[model samples]
Target: MKFQQPLRNWGGSLVILCLLLYLTLGANSLEPLLGPLAPENAPAIYARNSFIDLVGWHLLLVLIAISAAAVIAILAALFVSRPVGADFLPLARSLANLGQTLPPVAVLALAVPAVGFGSWPTLIALFLYGLLPIFENTLAGLGSVPTTVKDAARGLGMSPLQRFWQVELPLALPLIITGIRLSVIISIGTATIGSTVAAKGLGEVIIAGILTDNLAFVLHGGLIVALMAMLLDGLFVKLERRFATV
Candidate 1:
């Protein structure tokens, strides 16, 4: 059974890795066949960067944006979940929901006035849009920890801080990770719109395709982003399963 489980995990990992590789290389390999489809007078299919450059930099920006959102959301969730901040939970929830309530494009448009375009405004928009899920899940996970478990920890002479670190946080981790995973996937899709704000991401290709009426560019960009989201979500699923076993 143990051997079978490890083998299954290895197989899954290998499959995902191959899929990622195909997503990364397949479009470029097929470009020759697909390139001819573009209108004879169409502008260049995509911006000046090579495929690797486009995907690599776009991914980096996405990671940066999501990482920032995770940090901010987790910290804020932790704060509001505490007893001292309990009264402010409703307000926090509202603020978190506000991100999703506004369209990413509108967020970008509103932000550009202050941040003035490029990746910064896009980052801000993604960060805001990602907050609600993480915040809600964090709250749910932390709140779901049993009262009896907390009481037992207290009876065992564990300090509140110790109990939180060793017990509550560990128990809540899987759900928190789930929230992070969802936020990341959603961010990956939405980040494409960043191109409209002058940020470099896969969305640039999609937008360019729209401008030139080139479907190839749109397909390539969309495929890359979709594959990236699937890969990350798969990793997070493994992580969640591991946490579940614990």
Candidate 2:
């Protein structure tokens, strides 16, 4: 009976993956299915760039942005959680929220002037957007470790560094990963906007739809992002459950 669920999930995963492949690689095949939705006399497919390249660039941008954000956020959270750095927590928090406080468009506007168009502005915007959740989650995770656990580590003659590595970090990993999961998902959605400025991602397909009033193109791109997001969310959820069990 337990094995039945895994088999079902495996089947579902294959279906979603096949649909994703059709949308990204064989979009032309969808023309008949989507024909009525497209504007009259317009091509239903997004032909500016390969959808494969768009997906690749989209992933690259998100990965780089979130990776940079995670490093900074996790480090700041670690520092401020310690006794010596506790007083600086507010500062760290404010910095983490600085991205969320300003809309991505505003960041892009400000960044474009300094960094110019293309991926740089998009990367900066995503980096800023990813900071708050990671920092807050890591901080919360560290704080959730019981006082007795630390004492117990001390009781075992472990140093502060050893206590953190051997005891606290493992307990806190699930939440830290939760922060990463959130960041990764948010970055994926946000990276789409980078296309407006020629950053070249799935957003290009959506923008094309909007410009030509082709709902099919928009659906094409949206479905691809949505499916990929679902798949990734499922993967992270499994990770969260696995670690929670541990």
Candidate 3:
């Protein structure tokens, strides 16, 4: 469903309100991090710049993880969506559960020993942690497709590939978006852990804040990350609704 203009505007307004809150409350409290912005410095601008730079720095790796997960999810969904593919359901479920059961930090630590620090280990860990929600959702969404729809699509002379693309996928999109939204939000949270390995992100500011007892700084970094995740999730939800309506 195309979100009506009023609803879309309302979403935008809510985001603006959040930013304002972050600026007014979160920023003021953040004086601990920056030791009060200098006369020449603008705290809000500085925070915004830091958040943007942090995202820019890791954008490529995050994209890699997201792309990999999407590909795997698509394949898994297609496979499990078919009647003959029932045998793999147990394995898919196990994999999804196992991915989450393994602690990402522990995985990161183990990976560090082999891969050695920086972004690689962190990326791997985050990627693994992210697989479950997306993979499971993909499988579940596809499985939930009405059998009648599939039969009709097949009867209409649509090839397996064509039916999958046209029928199964469109019906499954909302669930897929929900999975992706969860993965993206989880990735945002996990990315902060990357700072421990000296990979740059908002986590660096947070870690610094913790080490220095700069409440303002830590809160500033954290608040920014939270806001970013919420914004992305909100956008994805809109997309989800639109696709579901189609």
Q: TM-scores of all models?
A: 0.87, 0.89, 0.80
Worst 10 residues of 1 by lDDT: 1-10
Candidate 2 local Cα displacement, residue 87, angstroms: 2.6
Q: Rank the candidates by TM-score, best first.
A: 2, 1, 3
**RMSD (CA, Å), each prediction:** 3.8, 3.2, 5.1
Ranking by lDDT: 2, 1, 3
Which of 1 and 2 is ahead in TM-score?
2
Cand. 2 TM to true fold: 0.89
Q: What is the C-alpha RMSD, rounded to one decimal, of candidate 2?
A: 3.2
Per-residue lDDT of candidate 3, residues 1-246 (tens digit): 444644234567487557845554555454554555322343322353355567566555566777787777777767765778789878878878777777667777776887887888778876776777888888888878889999999999999889988998888888988898888877777778778987667788778767756565576677777666666666777788788878
Give the per-residue lDDT of model 2 (tens digit) for 1-246.
Answer: 235344226566778778888888897788898888898998877888888988888888988889899899888888998888989988887776664676667766677788888988889888887887888889889999999988989999999889888888889889988998988888787778777777879988898899888998998899999888777666776687678788
What are the per-residue Cα lDDT tens digits for candidate 1 across 17-94? 676676566655666755776777654345466667777867787688778877887788888988888899989887
Deviating ranges (above 4 Å) for candidate 1: 1-16, 41-47, 97-99
Count of clashing residue pairs in every prediction: 0, 0, 3
For candidate 3, the TM-score is 0.80
Predicted structure 1: lDDT: 0.77
Local distance difference test, candidate 2: 0.83
How far residue 143's Cα lies from its native spot in candidate 2, in Å, is: 0.6
